[model samples]
Target: MEGVSFPPLSRFAVCCGTHGNEMTGVYMYRHLQKQKVENITVTTILSNPRAVDACKRYIDIDLNRCFTNALLCTAITDSSPYELRRAQEIDAEVGPKGSDEAVDLLCDLHNTTSNMGLCVMYNSSDCVAMHIFKHLKSKITSVPVRAICSDEPISEGYALDSVGKHGLSLEVGPQPNGVVRADNFNVITEAFNHIIEWLQQFNSGATFEGGVEDVYKMTEKVDYPRDLNTNEITAAVHPQLQDNDFKLLRTGDPIFLSFDGETLRHKGRELYPFFVNECAYYEKKVAFILGEKVTVAFPSISVTKN
Candidate 1:
């Protein structure tokens, strides 16, 4: 494939606090609000301010899940949920999504209780996002940088970043909710610094050489073992699987350890696992997500000269 040129990414948004307890983003939003970059119209947003004030993930529903077109276009009513209303308000600010008025790029900051390092997540095979991931992989050496493609269509994307023309989420962790670890915080700081640098270079017409890179495409989610009658979790992630995000899991490998001391093994073909035992996923009923690792090829990209 030939190199691709995209319009300069002028209007950019860095959003945080989509999940209120993810303190890294909550604080990063405040940190970034003080900084500025030349030529880029930076819009810093503290998404879900009420959730941040209360230090809860959300009040009525997950704000991150409220961005689907069906939900965003729904009419506001006297009893609309707080997050749905907030989503609309945010869409009005940075989005009104899938329109030309949306920001050129949006990076949503998030933290996880799982041990995944610095992971960049996107909904599609966007060249600009791929280039940004490639640049971050080169610049940020403190932690492993990886990319995950959820493969959802933009209009159906449920996250805040989906509001932009080009969007990705910077998710880092092993940090506990409501607590900020200096190490994790520094990783996010360095990442944003590098992202800003990449943007500046791209806007200046720098042609980034692209090649094949490994990306994990999310396949399916695994839920915790539960009692049929009680509807309560009956087992925990096996010690072997705990904190082992991105490890390949083979059929017959231990996946869960029951309270009664019996071990449960994996039952399917081999695949990589991520978000293993996420703290927030307890409510979502996801023990972890499995993904298929595949190499993706991208073309060299540069800002189209006006």
Candidate 2:
């Protein structure tokens, strides 16, 4: 494939605290506020101040899910949800989504209760995000680095990062809500440093050699078994499957254990599971998500000199 060139990424945004209780990003956003970089404008935002202040996942709705074009274009009113209003404000600052004035790159930070370590999530069509994922995977040796691709267009993406011309979510995990684990925090910090280094190199006209990468493409969400009468969860993630993100689940593999001491087995074709037993996903009715591992090829890319 021929090399692809993109205009120099001059503006960047690092957004965190979209979930409020995800402490790694909240603190990282604070740390980044005091730092400066050369050649690029780095705008750091604490995405949801009120939610962060309360240490809650969100004020009214999940801010991470409020950036779809429809939501961003919605007319704000007194009855609008707090997060909806904040999403519009954020779009005005770093986005205006799908416009030329949007930031060159936007990276949103998040933490998960599941044991997915140092994962980058982005739309599969984003070559820049894919390259950044490859760079971070190659550079960060302290923890496992992986990428999850949502095979969709950026216009349909709902995450905060989707507002930028190129966007990705830097998600690290096994950390609980409202708490900061030192190891997880350090991993995220190192990732940001590497991302900045990559930006500097790309802006300086370095060509990045890209190749095939194995990524997990999100397929479906699995919810916990609920009681019919009370509509309450009746099963929990099996011990064998808990904290085992990225493990393949085959037919007959144990997935859930009912309160009555019955083991529930997987019934479908084999697929890798991620975000296993996530805390926040409980409310979202997602026990975990299943994905298929597939290899994607990206072309070498360089910054287009003006």
Candidate 3:
């Protein structure tokens, strides 16, 4: 892991508990807000606070998926669904959508039931994001950083981190929903502190020159085996592939297994699998994402490919 000539950050935004039951981020955010740091002002949001209190994933819909432009349009007129309205409110507070002017950066924190480790997920090819990603990877050399850039035409991007400025979502897991593991908490807290200190260093006129060798870029999303008639998931992640996030999946790799003991193997080209069997993804129909490993250099035009 190397460093980048990161720029100074002034105002920052963080959305915690976006999924409600992911308590690691919620607890971490609660811990961070009470402390004071210099050179950067922050706007902290406890997204889906009601859901957090209820110990549920969401009060209505997943806030992470409800922040798109097309959905936000409905959020304005409908105002009925809790998450839809909450998305609008969040946009006004820390997004480019409404009244609350977005700041210099944003970091939406999350946890998963799958073994995602610590991933810095982002959509765009913004240089600032690349710089930050480079810096975070340098801090935690073992953790993987992921880029989920949109390759197809989308009405708007999904996820809260996309709403604000040049930042990303940090997802750490293998912990169940509503449960906070000390190991996960310590890792997230360390990453949070690293971001703070990195920003402080940047503001104090620190410059760096670093580059990335390879990165996993999510190219497609795979759905779990579902019943066509009822549209219900009918299979589970194959035992052979469980907890195999960030691993290579070949054409004949086991992907899922039916309850009745039937196994389904992937018959596609080579790909890297991540977010396998994530609990929150059940509703979204996503079992995992198929990523393409590409040679890339940070802060270069090569990474700007969408």
Candidate 4:
């Protein structure tokens, strides 16, 4: 079958299963399909078939990373025997030839390995993006959820980026075993329902604000500091790193005072250890931090406060 369409209305595309191990959305998609939602026509497309089978991030290439125009053309050509068939099936369901009626909305399901609460990854623009997200957050705040900036560096090559080029990315946090998973699933699914209901309610006079601008230009992905390899500490734990403390590392902070591993130093006068990926045991020690602003390895060295 090419596709199973409801009546003729705005398409609310719900894409799930982009990452293999983040299987919460896959189950939620199944649950959503079994139900009877009214108004907006919903189409749930399952990406990353190989990843889902292997239960790995991606098989050959990260499907999320391979959405560039050049790569999309190449991938459609290089499909394997099994993949070729599966690709065809998915195409039938949601290929380029699908409806072009100004697709009003898009939502993707995702889970994180880090137990970092729920958040929606959205393009800085899209007026309704924040509206719906805030609404969902208010409901889940008893559960307590936050919104991750789509322009933030962490969320790069995300399915949200692709769809947000057309729709929006709805990342529903990590699953706290089955209980939190159920709650997340219900809440997010209900959020989707509300989107449709809102669309129908405001169909007559829905006004979309222009893309988000002014503060900082939104980016496709966040830039990560590079060459922090070997034994260099970009930022370090002076004494004790708290929950939401921001540490700015200047010259001479005993980045690698002990000096066990090989250290990485910079060219300009300053020469202190830059520690990025240090040990295997330490989960997210120096890699990431939770605060207002984050420093990225980009054109400039330091990052301003958010």
Candidate 5:
């Protein structure tokens, strides 16, 4: 497929399909490519083609988890035809000298396995990212929740992390065939369109009302696992407490019991609740610990909107 182009702006980009199985964004991006945009131009990138074809997350490597200046150089220098071609495409948009004079924005689309609703993932450290996130939230209030921190630090070298650029990892649902895929698409499309309009205001030399806030700086990302299995293969979950207010349990408090068609037993030590349901049969992305409350965080927004 050919990359979509429009009237040249300072700079803009939309990258998706980092994971082959997570492809809702890919379909949406392809649809967008069929049309013509104005002022803000976009270059579309499909991170892992082999994985997408295999219906898996990756082929040789998790492309999303492999991003570094050295890696890019290696890919370009090692004479890997595919890597060289991919590098050229990427460099055309955000190369060392290409479009560096302008503000470059990347909107990454992704899907989740856990049953969390639609949410946007972004680095709050960047003001441009914050503005895009806030504007998207305002435009698509029904969906399109808060921006999230990436799982990159744990995965080591992530393309988004090493790029030294601003982007949003837009996670939109439970899975590829998740229930809210359509809603997720709408949220991201509306957000993109709204961003276009918001940027247009600046292009016309109009004063924008909202700016990045200090509160945005207060945002932090901490990863917690909803499912944890000991090396010995012991799996235990916290007991179903009186209410969802189960965070009152201390670290050493007694948790719950797992049965294998045997005697019932309670597990000692108060294990925190990343998620009440931690079954391997189900997808468990992450459990976010909020203020005095521990809920699923991977694909869900930190904030709740009425």
Candidate 6:
């Protein structure tokens, strides 16, 4: 996907430290905002300054989760959650959800505590997104371009990326919360730079394109085993699956181990599981997200984001 850059292309780079403790995005945004790229114009934002300052995930609500159209249209006031008003401010800055000021592409930076080394998430089956991941997979090490498709039928407004035209959220992890790993930080920087260079090339009349890619699109969100009476999580992620993100699991594979001696097994078809036992998702009851790998053939077939 390497090509000579010519003219500039305008885009937006928003690093929402919505979960402020996820420092990969925060630190990378700080670095990239300082160094400017030519021809490829960008509007970078540190989405949650206060949360980052407190060294916590969020103040009231997750800022990234406050972007649904209904929420965006709401009037901000002193009574509202900090994230609610902050979302409104950010929507105005880079995007008022489809206005002229809205960036052509939105790059939301994120990180996870799971062993998910590098995951690229997009709204739908966007060919442009596929092409970007294809190029990135070939370049990044330790992990390939594992893509997550957040296909929303209606405006969920639960993420910062949902407010833009064409956008992708870059999640890099296995690092803990509230701290920066130089190695992880370096990978994040490299991935973003690669995308920027690729975008410049594409806008400059180069087709940094790919034909097809095998991406694991999220099919269902699996919650941890909970005690029905007390609603407390009763089981934990199986030892076999720990740090085994992106590995294909077949029918009857161990997925969870109960507090007692029983083991919970997967009974469905072969599937790929990532974000296995993510710490932040514990509150949401998401033990892990179950996904299926599908071939995304580009150019030949037109796949819309809707």
The clash count for each model shown is 1, 0, 0, 12, 4, 4
The whole-model C-alpha lDDT of candidate 5 against the native structure comes to 0.48
User: Between 1 and 3, whose TM-score is larger?
Assistant: 1
Cα lDDT tens digits for candidate 2, 237-299:
999999899988999999999999999999999999999999999998999999999999999
lDDT tens per residue, model 6, 1-306: 222222234575555576788898788767876887877667778888889999888899888788888889998888999989989988888787766567767778887888888888886645566667777888887565588776674255468876666677888888888878987888878887888877776665664544667777888888988899999989999998878888998899999999996899998888898999888899888999888988766652222222
- Candidate order, TM-score descending: 2, 1, 6, 3, 5, 4
**TM-score per candidate, chains pooled:** 0.98, 0.98, 0.87, 0.59, 0.63, 0.90
Which prediction has the highest lDDT against the true structure? Answer: 2
Instruction: Give the least accurate 10-residue stretch of model 1, judged by summed lDDT.
Output: 123-132
Off-target runs (Cα >4 Å) in candidate 3 are: 1-7, 73-79, 98-100, 141-155, 227-232, 300-306
Give the clash total for candidate 3. 0
Which stretches of model 5 miss by more than 4 angstroms?
1-9, 75-93, 97-103, 149-157, 161-165, 176-180, 210-306
lDDT per model, in order?
0.91, 0.94, 0.76, 0.45, 0.48, 0.77
Q: Which is the better candidate, 2 or 6, if ranked by lDDT?
A: 2
Report the lDDT tens digits of candidate 5 across residue range 30-119.
877875677766666675566667776655555664454455556454545443445445544454321344235666677765344455
Clashing pairs in 1: 91-96
Stretches of candidate 1 exceeding 4 Å from the true structure: none
Candidate 4 per-residue C-alpha lDDT over 47-163 given as tens digits, one digit per residue, 9 for 90 to 100: 666667676655654455443333333444445434334434443455332234324466767765343445566654344555555556545543445555445332233343343
lDDT of 3 at 291: 91
Better of 4 and 5 by lDDT: 5
Best-to-worst lDDT order: 2, 1, 6, 3, 5, 4
